[model samples]
Target: MLNKKIVEKKLTSKTYTPKVLKELYKIFNLRTKQEKQKLRKILLELISEGKIYKDSKGKYRPLKDNLAIGTLELTRNGTLAFVWTESGDEIAIPAEKLGNALHKDKVLVEIIGKWYDLPEGKVIKVIERGLKKIVGTFQPRGRFAFIIPDDPKIQYDFYVPVEYFNNAKPGVKVVAEIVKYPSPTRNPVAKVIEVLGYSDDPSTDFPTIVVKHDLPVEFPEKVLKEVAKIPEKVTPKDLKGRRDFRNEIIVTIDGADAKDFDDAVNVKKLQNGNYLLGVHIADVSYYVKEGTELDKEAFKRGTSVYLVDRVIPMLPFKLSHGICSLVQGEDRLVMSLLMELNKEGEVVDFEVTPGVIRSYRRLIYDDVNALFSGDKEAYRKIGDLKEQLFLMKELKDILRNARRKRGAILDIEGGEVKIILDEKGHTIDIIPRYRGEAEVIIEEFMIKANETIAEIFNNFDLPFVYRVHEQPDPDTILQLKNYLSALGINFKLPKKIQPKLLQELLEKTEGHPLRSSIERLLVRSMKRAVYSSTNIGHFGLASYAYTHFTSPIRRYPDLVVHRLIRNFLKTNGKLTKKKIKELNKKLTKIAVHSSKRERTADEAEWDYTALKKIDYISRHIGDVFDVVVTSVTKFGLFVEIIDKYISGLIHVSTMNDYYIYNEEKSILIGERKGKIYKIGDKLKAKVIKADKTRMQIDFEIYNEEENKSNIN
Candidate 1:
């Protein structure tokens, strides 16, 4: 009874709470504090028994307060903020009080404030740390070294002792891990795990980024060995219990550089004048079963990442590029969804079957577009498949109409800066790539397949991972409307706003100076697409049901769908209640992971592209061009150069003439001269300077009347 009271007193006391004592015990085990304090600081986080708390001044007070658990999101300034799971409220902790907290650490954060605005916290216990490896450039600093993180979000440079360098030098990029980060230390101590080579090494840098982000570079040795042991040729076992479609003249339509094909199409005009369209997806589940090493690896990867120059696939190359890839002239396993559609594009009849089929040809987008447009050269190349090609075009248009009518967000084909590389993988030129009708046709076909499969699960009353996008919040929409109105654009607010209204606004803004900017705003207003087990429907597709079921080769959710469909189809035709519940939970977790990975990949890709574009423009410094006013603020007018397509600021003081900014109109009006510079107006400008490192371009308006005589 005395011991219990002592323990209770310790838990509620101001110093060394029960949680902290447990953590201290774990760190020390059976030793004293003097002995444990000498060890590295990072290893201290391994003692996850403590709670985090907040002091009076919005600062962390570790060991002094009870731990409150929350997920940590660290800022570049080294401050920690986390959302409390119980209240859905966020609190900030200053860097000084954070102790050894790292970004993405889940810790017990003790709340201190009654109000939301000034809430403070201290981390009581660290539930988890982001165990993901980090990539950075290492620099030797006398006796110790520090690594400048590649990810700008990672606020702190890791402190490394000279002994831990493993012979790595300054200016070299490397992968490393935090060894210790004690409360008293200014920087986290780390050890170089791998030297990835110099910054100029493109291949190594790209792959290192891939690895550092926890993206799989290659298949696991065991998985690769397993794939190799599988028979190369189609056998009787592979053909057993499958529908045969060997005689069908099916073909795959993909990008010119596409290697792994997951979908093939066959559309024919039936006797009733309705179309019979076959959407055959490669049955990867047949080879990669659940609970296997391959399945585990695929689940971990979540989805394939496609960068400008390369692809980081979820599965091993042998399976993703070989066995499961829908290559031409090869019999492959498939989960077939054959639908009979009338001229109105309504499904008349449908059949789902496990099947085996052979692809007749691999048709690239350019050749297909030429063939569809009656190009004789394309016909001369593949004259025999004319009838099938015509059917595909018609079917694709029907599906497109169905999608657009259902209120799918339609985006204009944006310019893609393709980084053309030479033999040594050095950037040669960055050319813009346009999307053609062929690409749209493939997209329409894939959407149809995805929707059809989603409907199949809905009919079976099975829980599945859905690709969902919720409607924009009313506040966000109102804000967007106000932004548009301020830009001198009349975007009328609907009584009840719909996706169609936003789409119409985008359409109206086409060819305007603010087209891309406005489109980006609208996209930003909309909720990010995410994976969810809950059947809320897809707001983007305007569908009552939606799931990613067509891209199993690249996406793990699709694989789950494949497994679920096959399990139910091949078994007694009903999923057990328990199994369904378990799948729901599992898929929900997968949805979160897949969504996170998608966002991470997007950020990385955007960073890389933006860097390259800025670097390219830096070459032609001080060049003038026509500029468009994107935004007019009280301080300055944000302008985008026409030829370079880069943004820069023109400060108010640099306007030369006395001007007053019209806040409501989002325009700048010269008071004395009465000259107006608005959001969409074109202006002549001279490139004053370019800062490549900061990605800033300085411009001075041409001031035609005043500066014309002196400039030339």
Candidate 2:
């Protein structure tokens, strides 16, 4: 009988063109009626998969060879780009050739020409629209209204009629549902489904970001009911076949504001002078079974989102913060990784099993850091646990040294902005959140556990999701080399680049004036890390195998790993072929979905942070601050405020004299005054404008001499 692959092969070959069903059957030499029926089914499947299309006269043909499938990325200026999913190559699409496609839409494009030495293409068909609703500000126009979308990539404003205003007033933020998609001659028509409120309201900004990104913020009633049925504590039956670690002095170390405690650690010295490390993570899979309402919702969320003001948890609070959380003095069900490491931080042996643990203490990062710094008060707070903490710290240092020796890329200069809000939820201050030594200890331990678990699963040949980070493309490496050369740094990049080369360059430029800018460029040149069912070595970590085995309470992929481990244990460490295949398929889908959701969460968090920073700067208009030039472009100099670390643009128009941009040297030379501005140059700038709606801040050079003279 004919199958989908056979049909595709026949259609793709040049032996025949489009043919009717009878002609296709004859080409394949099918005789029986059943075989013909199978051929028909195969043709339909091929059409559904977009591998081939049926013509108006009912003949099937393969899609154009020049056609490539990818997602359409639209820039703020309405320029379009198509990023191929398979090759990761991007092709430019002129605005006129974009047709009706929207931002992030799944599109098929035909390669046309070259623009700026890069491939260019025209979108032929939009397979799927990326947006159903948009968050924007409403501008009323007498009888009709329009919404200016908050997302800059959305080029067209959605037109709304008078009756579809949803009682929203002009200048009010709203969520507009698209009723009619845009065409060549017309803009998109939409109806206001919700009115968020004024743009100045700080409370409206966060929620607008959430809605704009389509984050799953609320759980369904069925899922809530399921959460209600869960018990508050582990039962005796639940502890069956689980290792008992409740007697051990396990401790959970986290940030001060953290609520969901998923992982706990314990360490002790063995008789052979080796260290035994215990990493106990909450076993959420034991309660949230597959295909359940809770599981579905958790899978949809993928991971907990840590926004500035709140947390949108993957699981409900009852599970994430109550039962599954490894809270202090709480008996919880956990999946633990026990490893025996030599003094040199090499893993000698390891074991993974379901365990019941009772955490003895919950230590905050600040206290632990102070204790390590020999603070008497912090040591007194830890009391008897000081020795264990010291041992953990020693082990962490050993592990870190081992990792560094193995050439792990450590890009660690960036810090998150900590937004502080007033009682009315208005932004008051923005500060940097620094990661201390205590946080690094926890991170090293988790990475070790993840690598250990991934190695175990890989050896067993079981289906599992791995945290894979492929090496950077050669083009990216060449670009970095060019940029560094322009900066007067003589670093030679090899034809085949590795993480070690990047690491060495970073070390050489550690204390340079352009260190931060170089680090930022290097990071941008690397590929994003994501999850995959296949085992691709993690280039950034210098590890052959890696996976997420901790924080099951917050991350859905960790829960999946726990489930796979639990199933292996239940089946006596053996899985059938059928079960393995099913698991492989399931894990693949999960990896893609989880990676996408994680990206969405990251975008939302960044947008919210940018909004808060703009709001904070809005209150300080006309204030002068010291800034460092991060990059010099033809249009302006991009500068970062030294104190606040907030980046803004200093336009060339704001300069006192005309400046000529030096493309080769990446500097700006004042034509009249001969003043020069380059990256890493420090100057003072006064804030001129802050547009909260656009999330932009404008700055003008501050003349210290003129200000001093005025003061005199």
Candidate 3:
């Protein structure tokens, strides 16, 4: 017979099974009878409170809670409650009370206290309902049907009736509106609003995402009719009360596929050896007046959504892509910003004007970059303005250097993946999109314009929308410092880490193997930039004052800036005091909604693109490729395959090497073998399985190469 004390040590030592120290005495024969009896009573009481559960046979497990009220983030296995307290302390809910709550559903929860290693929360009541519809594949069972959501995080399938199928056939992809959510036994009931088609249908996913997010893809009849009443060309009377830039010889720069041109640039040398540069933005507010159908619709949409293949414009096509596009050879309404800068790129004086302009040419980024870089073909198109173009290039370089010194985060080494398409609209291959000198020229000019406008409002003590980003949390910065400290990367940290410090770190990491991985971590620790009436400084741009004064045709904040500038200019620099109070209140509400919608749209688009990328890679299984571990969890290692540009999972169990998770360090280390596989380490992996339906990929390390070639 085995002694009870020996049995307890065996269980604890072999499996590290979690147990309350007091409870263990109840099951084991202690020398003191009184201690045993007391432990039994306490253990029984804990069991009665339902704060713990026993396994199928008889092993006790803690019931996780630690209560909270938070938005639910549902996952395939369970759900996590994301709670933000009044003091801004963020905590995650335990796996138990996730219940039937889906993503973004606000709910109240009861905290059950902490388990061995994780905080636990249990759902009590749903505080708010999510109105967004789910896109999925329709599964029909005789007269009944259900939609298995495309997002795995949506734990429950939506139930549907035969009549609510909306002409959708079995196994077809569709959009279902949830009518009823799940309780104990039942699933969510739904009504079908759209039948997309077979999962393999060409370009079906694009429109599906647009509709799922309730994005406006078409114009309302009234809005279209209103735009039709506007004149096609600028009239003489239209030039009234506007600065005329007709002789500026400005040109619009965009992509070859771009149709709606919202910005134009002009540069000239001043007599004092200073440069006079103008950034003229299309004055959409001048055409689409307030309280009209066109304005209302645009306000509701907030901003245009640009997906991979299509765009959902805020206004009708007649206005967005035609009347106010700043098209070449056509006079257009503009709000212009003129700046006088010394040869060293320091702004001496700046002026904002409500203006009318004619775009002398519509140049693409690639063409302009090539011409600026001394390509003969590009120079031929520029004709006699070569000297002016050369001076603009010098100014751009100076301005770029100034921004770097000011801690502005520039797009220097990052690359964008662009999908090339065939004539029939099918994807051909993935190509890298590069931003050359021309792109930087526009970006530098736009940043300066935004800063100038922000300063204008600041100096006047006027209310306005400012794009702001606060410094990273002290705790997050400390965590990051500790994380990099272990890797021997040291840097100076102020009482609080500023954007300039972050930018400096980024610059230091450029071209390193760990650049992308480390930059991602840094960015993840920072809050997103947003528009606000509050004048908090922007941390990302390292700017004390920043506003969206460049893209008025697309961003609502820019439109507000346009209106504010017009009001101020109309009164001859005397700030309008009467209407700004009311306008500021309205703009605040607009800013909140616009930011929320923008985040939602960004999430949906990224998910859609990831899905497509996974699908494309699913067709090429058994292919061997080099990969980098992008993320690590208890369950698996996520690796991004270089050849396909798709990320997949490598279950930790398949590492086939003895590994130990160092939780405190957020790393996984191997035992016995000194082989270290950390985040950003390059490894060759062969695809073992690819599931398009689940958007999952499985990989195994290519061990054969280990013996033949030295990985390190």
Per TM-score, the best of the predicted structures is 2
- Worst lDDT window (10 residues) for model 1? 40-49
lDDT of 1 by residue, 1-712 (tens): 2232343344445765333433644634526565455322322332232333433343333443334555566654454455333222357776655656766676666665543454787665555676456778889999999987776556677889988998898888888877875345477778898997875555554655564455667677888777787666567799888999988988898988998999998998999999998989989998888888888888887888887677888888877888899899998889898998888788889888899889999999889888877899999987688878877888888887776776677765443456666565555566656667778877877777778778777777787888888777787888788778876677777667677777678778777767767776787788878777777777767777788888899998898888878877777457778988888867766776677667666765665565455545555556667888877888888887653446788888887788897877777889988988877778887777654323466777876777767776
Candidate with the larger lDDT of 1 and 2 = 2
- The sequence of per-residue lDDT tens digits that candidate 3 reaches over residues 482-525 is 65654557887789676778877777767665555566568767
Clashing pairs in 2: none
What C-alpha lDDT do the candidate models reach, one value each?
Answer: 0.72, 0.85, 0.72
So what's the TM-score on candidate 1?
Answer: 0.81
Which ten-residue region of model 2 has the weakest summed lDDT? 80-89
- Whose lDDT is greatest here? 2
Query: Which residue ranges in model 2 land beyond 4 Å of their true spot?
Result: 1-78, 82-97, 104-122, 482-489, 511-515, 576-578, 708-712
| Candidate 2: tens digits of C-alpha lDDT, residues 458-559 | 888889999999898888888788778766777877777778888889888877766667877887798888988999889989999999989888888999
